[model samples]
Target: MSSKTVKLLLVGIGGYGHFYIDGIEALADQVELVAIVDPFPAQALDWPTLQAQDIPCFDTLDAFLATGITVDLAVLASPISFHADQSCALMEAGVHVLCEKPIAATIPEVERMREVRDSTGKFLEIGYQWSFSEAVQNLKTDILSGHYGMAQCLSTHVAWPRTSAYYARNSWAGKIHNAQGAPVYDSPVANATAHFLHNMLFVLGETQQSSALPRKIRAECYRVNPIENYDTACLEVETEKGDRILFYTTHAADANDGPSFLYRFEGAEIRYEIGGDIVAYLADGSIKNYGNPEGTHMRKLDVCVAKVLDADGATTPICSIEAASSHTYCVNALQQIPVYTVDPAYLQVKEIKPGEQLTFIPNMGVHLREAFEQQKLFSEMNFPWATPMGAAVVVCPIHS
Candidate 1:
């Protein structure tokens, strides 16, 4: 496979697909952009250049597949509802896939994708940017080597404020289910800030390409915006190993803090803050630094390409579907729990940008930061508007 230029089919170039287009520029010598699959390909920023280069665009994956054009890899940047089916179809047609994160909204979809991937012997790497980064891989390696001892607890805090324009940009941005009734579950944790939530599970994974199975979830789901899904969520997940995972994220936060995480281990405490390095504080009074994970966002494509082409030393174990399913399990469980509507008293609507109005909880970042520091959910911290949801449990027959 390394003897030839790898053929790549780009699925969806409207929004996040730009990342792939940019990545292809860097990998120009190694990969061939065979075709594009998007309902609205012209909407992409690179449409004119691609068209002049004779790159044909199809309105759907099936249309491109029917063309009988061979492809080595298909990067799926489509909506969440389409992930499982698109990936399955591509894999069944003998194409490897690099799917965007969360795997899928339902466990059945995740199972089906994994089954097809296994049967077809194709790698389906989930595009969790951090999971493909050097910093995270090093951290996972250390955890597996028991350098940090047993993981005591892991917590993450992300407060990215998004306005209506963000949600209105696409049909499935804040939707719980798509127009076809397929589960989308697009929320802060599932979509925009998903990298952080999955990072917690990914590092605790038993293997490089797996995530720890979550057995139970206690959460507080809330929304200050009028979106169908909650913009704010605080989840406490209990893994199969009985380790604790606390994740907090809010699109309705008043501030634009990127993401900060603390992973507590018996021998050391690992910490990473936005605009900072992932530093581990050890019991021996020494500090170990893993460079920032954010810089390698485009490396996801390189990692996938290497695996697809079987390049020397590039048979990298990328994040597999089974590994990313942990995030889906937690998300599906969160859907079973109720989402409380934030009362008007605790909410404020502001027009941060013209034609981009946003609904936010006043001082939400501060409140959630407090919860994160103590590894507690909003309800446990006595937020008056926060209502506790009963423990939502997921049964992962594959892992359990």
Candidate 2:
């Protein structure tokens, strides 16, 4: 750590990069934007912002590193497939990193990154912002303190629809692999709703364990859109302690009304509505609502900046790479199982406009909510369209 301000590099100036830019600007007094590395900066929707800010840009990470510039930190908002190589390379060059989540596409990649971070003795944090929420952290504390008693189950349901334009937004939007043959696994669970998945893991285990490692995963993935990965997914995970975790999410629905989660314990229930509200149901039938205010994403960046500037390391990041490995492992395991498409007879598609359509399963939100409330798998509810995940089970090893 230095007495002077830290120099930060913004990598992949795309959709998510905008958040990092805003975050960096918010903490301008402690950090300076030295440069940006975007493989295709010209195509970035936020490229004009970078240009207007007078920040120099390079077309590749190698090109930026070649300049012999020294940045104290790198904020990676690149595609998932590129995370491991880029993070390790930057860290090897003596740069600390804050990478976007689902930390990597595979377990081995995350392991490799951990190895590099160990050898280089640099800090690497993953951008799972939900873990940094005060209320969420409080819930974790309560669970660990036995205020919630023994945990019984966890369930998550996110049903926000995506149009053709959404999937067409990028080359890796719905891909399993990028043009370079690197695994992307850019499905809903791996990318968009990854925070919720990671949050479930975080709440289940202490920050040291980070996530409750899944011993087996049974998933029924469906592709309504013509993409390499599933647009909709229903997953069941059995942890080492035999507690089950259920997840249901889709980008082929009606509206952005979800990613709601329910964490049921023997003594209480913690409920979270993505972009909405959070509430805890006590065993005594009392309702405790933990309002969901905004700004956690930006707050996380500020925390990272503070940690970088702190010589004694007093401020620590809520979500680090080691804590996010369980998420990466589950994602890797799910991607290995081939995705199944919903039968056309069960799907209802309506064209909203030219090159855009809303595809959904009728009463999807209702069904998903039911499953969550009951702590049941969608298939177990006996929906005619529900596909059994038993055959698709992929058993993954613990990160230890």
Candidate 3:
């Protein structure tokens, strides 16, 4: 119950950073917002909030660092590619960092940031927000307590539609690497669907034997839109501990149905479906239902605040840098493989207006589920552009 306040710096006040603002606002007593930084502050819808509060704003990390102003921790809600450099620079300046997810665009970047964190002894936390959810924590506790026994497999399918307007929000919106000469890598798996994949590794890594790292992977990455990155992908990975994860995800589907996951354990089966229901079927012929509480995306920020205020080394951030290495590896591996543009024969371009149109991936839903349930890659399911198992591209650093 320490009331100590951690002076905080807010970086990248646009897009998802709004959640961090909400989280800090909700926990105002535990932390103080010392400053804000974003290259394009005027682009943020919530820019007015910072302006109203009369908080000092800077256009770049260099400018902020030049001021010699510092804080207890910096929340990096910036681009995935910029995470490594920004986090390292801040930590070197005697600040802990909680970076947004996929940790960094590449393994080398993640490794460099880790070196800075180790050398400087500053904390580095990834913003995989679901890891901080009460429901997920209970699930992890159950898994550790042997209530679910050994995990057999984890699979998730998430499809949410996005119009061109969604991509038009920023210059780095849908590019593989930032075309604006910055390291802003934005892909569906690494950026938008990052939570689903990171959550898988986080929960599975909670067990003792599993390091939660991916040992091998086979993936089918396809782009339905004209973006530089893939809009749809199906992945099957084997973890270092011999566990498997089959993930089917995309942003080019017909609807925004939300994400769903199935975790099959030796002793039981838990299905986390859309609308926040956690249903477990046990070996005793009994069923248990847990309502997943909707957590503010900023909740992880709250957890970070509590940790910094208490100065507790024993208690770590919900998603620490080490824990997120596996997730970062997955992103890097996927990036190494070339993205195959979906055959125009399979796309139905619906004209939204004179100049804008939404690219729809035909029949993605059924095939995505089959890939997850059968623990197979999209190519194995006989998609026209899919490559078979032996022929599937393998770009993973660990497996290679």
Candidate 4:
């Protein structure tokens, strides 16, 4: 906390990094960009406006940190694998941090970063921007206020489409292994559907609970594409309170014409339909809609910054490393299940008319043979690279 204006640094200026530029412009009055770091030198060259402003841009974090620049906060949009090391370094340097979600690749990495934060006493906010959405905040207030009674069940669905070219665009997009264990950090729940899962967790107030943990998780996964990762999955999770959660995510289907994701409570529903707008329903049969606006994640980050600046030692409601770690675990659990293909015979059997003679086309055996052959082809092509060593469920001990 200083009397001077907040000076911020941007790290990893790639896809999401560019989106942060919009956020910076929105909050330009309160913050100034002192520096930017990206390995791709062309990224900075591509942005003439940012370049013309005389903002210092470097190709590496080591180079930027060596400049001895005085920055109050570091906005991390780096790759998922780099989060822990970069965050720990910034915290150790006495700069506050706003990091992207799935805080780190594993639970141990998350714990280490938390330890750094505790020792340095610097603010750390994991960027799960959906928590800051207007709809999410309203739902949280009502749920905590007992407006919905008790949350009996929760359901979340994320259905979007990604082509083979999408995975081919980046080397790490479909990987489960880098220098460390299985990158376990690819499509579906971990990337595309992450916000939906996080929103469900937020509305249910299932954040960082050590007493009532998820006791059981059963999952079914499918690999529709030729890649080495699952593109679709369905998960059923049971909490210690006996509450059930049904979570579904897929990147194989065609994009929906209407809303792509939805959240349902006992008496309320929130829709994030095709146009990117949000609508909520309450127990009183009232409806509220937030115009189909974009940059919702950026707004969440703004609130996160505000919370860190205003804290006198109270916990903030935004996502934390611990909560993000739990989410990573949830994704990992679902990925361990085997993929099953439906028999195709059920798809083509025609019904006979009352007066018509039945042509007994014995195609069931043929269809089963084709199904098994297709299954083998898929398994041989993908499973070798997709299967990771640590996909086993690791249940944390529940503390009273």
Clash totals in order: 0, 1, 0, 5
Task: Give the Cα error of residue 274 in candidate 1, in Å.
Answer: 1.0
- Model 2 weakest lDDT span, ten residues long: 311-320
Report the C-alpha lDDT of model 3 over 230-297, residue by residue, as the tens digit: 88888887787788888889877776755888889998888887777778899899987766735445
TM-scores for all candidates: the values are 0.95, 0.93, 0.92, 0.77
Q: In terms of lDDT, which candidate is stronger, 1 or 3?
A: 1
lDDT of 4 by residue, 1-400 (tens): 5334568898976778887888888877677889988877465434678878888988878788898998878999887888888999998998888888767766667789989988988878877765656656665666666655666556655456565566655667756655466464575777766766656555665433211245566555556555666665556566656665656666654433222445555777656655556776777889877554344758755764565556564245356664566576666665556554323332222233343221111332232223222422222324322233212333332211
Write out the backbone clash pairs for model 4.
Answer: 176-182, 176-183, 177-183, 259-273, 259-274
Relative to the true structure, candidate 4 reaches a TM of 0.77
- The deviation in Å at residue 287 for candidate 2 is 5.1
Rank the candidate models, highest lDDT first. Answer: 1, 2, 3, 4
lDDT of 1 by residue, 153-225 (tens): 9999999999898888887778998888888999998999998989999999999878998888878788788
What is the total number of backbone clashes in candidate 1?
Answer: 0
Which regions in candidate 4 have their CA more than 4 angstroms from the true location? 1-3, 44-46, 179-184, 206-213, 257-295, 307-317, 339-400
For candidate 2, write residues 1-400 as lDDT tens digits: 5567989999988789987877887777889999999878887777787799889999889999999998988999998888999999999999989888878998779889989988988888888887776777777777788887888888888888888888888788899888889888888889898887777778888554367778888887778888888888788888776778888888877767677778889988888766676788998999876667244767667767778888468225467765788787888788778777878788888888987887887777787778777766667788777776533878875533
Show the lowest summed lDDT stretch of 10 residues, model 4. 356-365
